[model samples]
Target: MRFPRSSGLLLHPTALPSPWGVGDLGPSAYQFVDFLAAAGQSLWQILPLGPTGYGDSPYQCFSAFAGNPGLISLDHLIQRGLLSYDEVVEASRRYDLNADQVHYGEVLAFKLPLLRHCYERLREGGAPDMAVAFTQFCRDQRAWLDDYALFMTLKEAHDGRSWHDWEAELRTRDPKALAEARTQYAEAFTLQQFFQFLFFQQWLPLKAYANEHQIRIIGDAPIFVAYDSADVWANPELFFLDAEGKPTVVAGVPPDYFSATGQLWGNPLYNWQRMAEDGYAWWIKRLRAAFTQMDILRLDHFRGFAAYWEVPAGEETAINGRWVKGPGAALFKRLEEEFGALPIIAEDLGLITPDVIALRDQFDLPGMKVLQFAFGGGSSNVYLPHHHVPNCVIYSGTHDNNTTVGWFEDLTEEEREVIRGYLGRSGSDIAWDFLRLAMMSVADMAVVPLQDVLRLDARARINTPGRLGGNWGWRFRDDVLNAGLAHGLHFFTEMYGRLPPQPEPDEPAEDATTEDELIYDPVDLATTA
Candidate 1:
């Protein structure tokens, strides 16, 4: 469905400022919501909120349905009498919490032990209400939660090896073996469930607070699940796996302009035939859960849904991959039947084909347009504001791109001249220039990264696609959300007709009676009719 005219910041919860080594669902999250509301934004876009695995990338998550435990607020736990302020402070002191960027290792070390402590305390006769709530949450989410919790427990039991690497019976998920494991690691399984409960307990309320302020959240969902995820382990038949549970073929892009050997994502390719047999039941469950956490979902790597690249499991690069037709309309048709009028945004950014366009148009899912890609071509460029359709989301720059300022600075003189000529400006404040372009564009939605809003440069770039380490760690300072900034952003919002409509006053003006004007009362009309 088409989105309303609105603007928001694309800052992940991890990017929010905090005293802890990493951002959490604490005071800063609420503060950011206030900032968005003050700026007249009706949307808040964030990256995937899943539990990151080896690379610490949200895209590579351990479970598609699970929340990131790292985002749970320890202060909230303290308020619940599960942890003490002194213990939190001590944990903070052990890490370099003052750093502007997240050190994932330090954050894990600082957070995990405390999280376990909270779980242990709660396990040993905690508050009655919380205990009841925990039981309810687990029961309500058992479709995926039980499998996920057990998967995590077993992973920890086996020194963090992937399920395929475990002993035969456990690797194959034999019923007897699973039962034995569950009995042996009962506490660990419950602890995993408790962590998930804390994550959603904090996140759901935060999402509701955004909705209360008329700010809808746009959350990212990767098209492919991680190879080592609970998604794969729990439902092996749905993927192209070998007898030993290893992927026979993986997901990636073929050679492209950017690289001779394309990006080998190494995610397992789904067995579309198998999934279709059950009418894509797994996808239905995944999306249903996603909607609970977010108002709108952005389907990442959307082209893959129409046709995806399939590379052999041991391939060094994506050069040898072949295009494999995907489930296309069948999967979406089922999803739409499950959840009517999907509030989805398609991440149709790379190498879009006719089938992908057809699939997107068929579902009426809004595509994305990035200002950073506008000047690379002439005025005919689709990314240019003039060429944008209203059924799309426009961004100054996405997480993958450098901040608008950094992008402008890195451009060649001719490229810079093209941008300056297009906008008719000196390009002194390029970030705002891009921001204004996005706001004034025909796209239904406009989203700018917080880095662009703050006019930070390359150092603040969220992620560089191919570079493995030191990504997704950028954080903003607490004091940056000033009143003046809100006022300025609000000006653009109002100027571009993106501000939400205000409610009419309860009392109207006491004016002289006008005979021609008739105000019909709903109650009178209903009774008369």
Candidate 2:
């Protein structure tokens, strides 16, 4: 199903300014909703909200179904009497408030123990209602929560080592060892679950505020699971892993712009045959969990659904990979049978093939078109605005690209000429130029990275794909979100008819609807699904 013609910002919560070092589901989040409403944006897009593991990449999460406890608001915990203001003030002293990037290590060091302290308070029976709420949450989410909680508890006991690094019995998930670990680490398991509870409790209210302000969230979901994640650790059979819990094959893309050798993502490739045997149960659960926290979902690495690049384990690069067939239409058919409707956007970028396009169009799910990729060729280029169809989400750039300014500087003379000729303008305010083009396009959804709006350079780029460690750390100051910027965005939104209609004060938010808007309906197109 096509979304309303709307525009939004691609600012992950981590990019928001906060005294706590990293942005979170806190008061600053509510203020961001105010900013979006004031800017005439109807959507707020964010990266995956799962618990980050190595390199603090949201895409490489510890658990697909778990919320990032680090994003839980300490201030909210204080308000709930689970924590004290003194603790928050004390922890704030340890953070680098003036730094323009997130220091994930420092933030985690300060926040995790604090969350544990709050968990201790809750266990002490300081709040009866909260205890009941926690119990109910665990009960409702037991299907995934039980394994995730235990996985985290084990990770901590092993001094933050990967699941494969655990004792042989635990690595193999021997039944007796599992039972013993559960009995011994029961307290740790409770604390881990408690942290998840805090994350969801804070996040729901923030989502409600955004919904009330007419801004729907567009959260992300990666196509593959991390090898060190709870998902692969708990259900090894679902992934292509060896007996010792190592990936026999991994996930990545073939040669692309990011690297000559291609990016060896090292994520465990799915055993689609096994998934199909279970009716795609894990995929369904993961999607259902994502829906609880978002209105629309962006399916990352969407080409993988049609045909995935499978790299042999321990490969130096993704160059030595083979294209494997994914579940294709059959998997999506199963999802539709269970969920009724799917509001999804396909990230159909990088080394796309006709088969990928066929799969994307089959569901009528909106695909993405990044304007940065448009200058690579001519008018026949799919990313160009003129070629964009209404069933797509256009972007000036995404998290993986250099900022518009940086991209323009790095372009070859030939590529530069192409952009100037297509745009019919020189490089003055190139970021805004691209933004205007995207907003005015026929695509049903238009999203601009916050960096583009601020006209920041490459230094603010979020991720570089093949590179490691230095990505996903950029943050914007509170002052950058001034009224003038809002006016500029609002002006274009109004000009392009992307400004959402205001709902009456008494009406319920469109996002709060019970049933999700499915991507495919009974459109008896002679060719498509």
Candidate 3:
């Protein structure tokens, strides 16, 4: 699907400032949307909103279909009578004041119990409408939700061990064992289900607000599922798992520039042939569920659909991986047949082959171009602004990349010289320079990370590949949003013609000088890690 000539900010909700440590769908979210509208943005691109697991990465989620209940707003719960204002105020006191990064363990401990309290209060309130809506949501999503809730409940029961390590009866999903578990932990299972219901409830209203304001939400959908995820445990047959329900081979990449040994992602490889036999029903359902929640979708690791790297089980590194034939065009063909004209943006990065480009273009899906990749090579590099096709989304950098300023600062002198020669500039104000290049590119949509807008250094980096710790925890302070920064962004959006038309008079004005001011320095980048 063709997106309008629009631009947006790339900020995960977790980055938005809040008293609860991590951002949520609270007043801050709505206010952020208002900021977007004021700045003339038509899109609000975010990372996957799934329930994070190990390493607190959204990509490594417990369930692809389930929302992160941690993102549920405690203040909103108070307004709904599920929680009291005093309870929220007391919880806020425990949050770490000095740690800008999310302490997931601490945050989860603080948030989940409160959410549980809310769930119980709502249940006790006996609001028939909410109860009926929750029931309907469960019914509508039973294809995935039931298994996910059960998987989460069971994981808790086993103290968070991988499903393969569970008892043989549960690991193999013996019907009798499952029935017994259902009976034994019915209340816990219901709680898990209720959490997802609340997540969807909160999310729907936010999405509606975006739609009402002429903004659209674009969601990310990673191609591979985590080995320990609910999807794999619930339907082991869909993956290349042995009789013991352990992955015989895993998903990864061959030797790429990012790593000498490549990345052993440790995700279970899908049994494509098995999926094809059922006409890719699992994939169809997954996409359908994603589309229900998001206006547009980005398919991450899109090249995996063309051909994927297979690393044998028990391998410590990706050096022993081999390329295996993926389901390819046949899979997308079936998807289009079922869902019709998917509004997908192909995350066609990393060791892209001719076949990957062919598969991407065949479906007419928009691919991504990162400006950070452009200047390391000559103008002929596909990532260069001049080479960008209209059917692409341009970015200064993605979640996996350092903030553009940090990236430029980290580059070697030789690399900086190459960048200087390519852009015909001294590479001063590197973040804005890259942002300007991306916004002025021929790509249909341009997204600038909020960190780049603030020109933060490596400390504000969202994720680092191959490293496990100290990632996905960055947040902005409320004071970070100021008048000058917003004006500058508005100027760029207006000058580049990426601004969307205002939806209504009462809606925030799209003028550069009228809205709330955001203060940002071209060079005073934050350097904390």
Candidate 4:
């Protein structure tokens, strides 16, 4: 799955500014697409769009296949007559303007009730068109949607307790218990399903707009399922879960730079042998569903495909974990059989072994290169831009790392000296320097974080590794997207020959800017820079 030569910005929709407290698939999202086009970017990469749980991390979702109802646009609802303009105006008035972060608690309290109101109106009005569309969506996605709707409804009913803590019959998914739940909570289930329909309805139009502008969307897919998620509960046979629906062995990383005890993620480990027995049907379906929403997918924790760490379920840390061989080549072989060439970007980060690289190359997948990891050593370091191969994506830093400015500010004297010596600078404008390095790198694609572009620091960091609280809540102010920033990016892109070519002087701009007619520069950054 070869990609055209291009560049993009990494910004989850949650970070987009909106008056409704949290960003949604609304007019602001389309405005973001327009911003990308104006800045000459051809990609818009985002984190998973799933409903977050516990720590509010998108990676740890309630359902891998369901959309986050939190992201459904209230403004869109008003246009559709499901909600009134006054309802939206009142809801917007309730948000705290001074909070620089997303108040998820306040947002959930305010938004959910309004969504329920909209759902009730739809039901009372006998909206056959909406009902038919929702029924058809469910029928087309029954393989996963039915289970997800039921899981969400039950989770709400149980006061948001983990599925493992539900009653023994429901915990083990007894057939009788499931049937009774469906009957008793039918309305709740329908509401959850309707929310997903609305999310997709808004999202598809935004995706089409991006496509029309010659921008491709890259979406993230975590390798493991949350222990308490619908994926684990509905298919207990696919994970290392006990008969009582509790995990026996869990997922985590071995001791690495980020943690001395290693990170115990606590997600249920997959039953690879079982998955292989069925021709990896579950994985195929997961990847297929992801493809429907994104043009290319980034497989998080790609090393897990080669081998994974197995930690006992009750362990407080990952110190006692052991390495177990994953399904590896056989699984990818089957994926290729089902999906043809895989349009995947392997998140080949953290304690990567030769085997992981081997498996990644076997599939012709592009791995990632982070410039922050480069200056710690000499030019031979794999992260150095000069050492990168064409089959890679380069970043200034990832979501888990501090914004480049923050990272630079926190560097020790010795590390700072080393960086100064490497780049022959005294570390002024560290963020922009790194951003320029990334844009000039030889990797096939380069993605700059929105935080780095804004020259923000740790205060605006997206995620901090090993830190549990006060993460994933950062949001940018609307005024941050001013013309100066856009023009600066446009200048840099055009200067480096990374921007799509301008039209002929006599040509009409609209006709010249047809979707298929956009010109993407094909200079291989790996070879040129």
Clashes of each: 0, 3, 5, 2
**Against the true structure, what is every candidate's RMSD?**
7.8, 5.5, 7.3, 5.8
Model 4 TM-score, 2 decimals: 0.93
Give the alpha carbon lDDT tens digit for every residue of 1-529 in model 3. Answer: 6778989889999888878878888888988888887777888899999998889999999987889988887777777677888987787688663347777777888888888887787678655656766676677667788899999999999999989889999998899999999999998999998898777777767876786677889899999989898999988999998888889999889886767898888999999999999999888878877887788999999999999999999999999989998999999999899878878999999889999999999989999999888875566898988789999999999999999988888889998998887778888888888878877888999999999989999999999987879999999888877767778888888999898865577877554421111111111111100
Global local distance difference test of model 3: 0.84
Give the TM-scores of the predictions, in the order they appear: 0.95, 0.93, 0.93, 0.93
Which of candidates 2 and 3 is the stronger one according to lDDT? 2
| Residue 457 Cα positional deviation in candidate 1, in Å, after optimal superposition | 0.3
Deviation (Å) of 484 in candidate 4: 2.4
Segments of candidate 1 deviating more than 4 angstroms: 507-529
Per-residue error for 404 in candidate 1, Å, reads: 1.0
Question: Least accurate stretch of 10 residues (summed lDDT) in model 4?
Answer: 520-529
User: What's model 1's overall lDDT?
Assistant: 0.88
lDDT of 2 by residue, 400-517 (tens): 8999999998889887877888788887789999999999999999999999999999999999876869888998887788899899999999999999997689987465422111
Q: For model 1, name the residue pairs that clash.
A: none
Error of 2 at 504 (Å): 5.8
Q: lDDT (CA) for every model shown?
A: 0.88, 0.85, 0.84, 0.83
- Expressed as tens digits, the lDDT of each residue in 1-529 for candidate 4 is 5565568899988877887888888888888888888888888899999999888899999877778988888887787788888877787677663346777777777788888988898788745666666666666667787899999999999999998888888888889999999999999998887787777767766787898787899999999978778988889899987767778999998887767899899889999999988998888878877887888999999999899999998999999999999999999899899779999999998889999999999999999999888876576889987788888999999888899999988989888888887677777878878877777777778899999889998998999877878888888887788778888887776666567655589976453333111111111111111
Name the candidate, 1 or 4, with the larger TM-score value: 1
Give Cα distance to truth, residue 159, candidate 4, Å. Answer: 0.8
Lowest lDDT 10-residue stretch of candidate 2:
520-529
Better of 1 and 3 by TM-score: 1
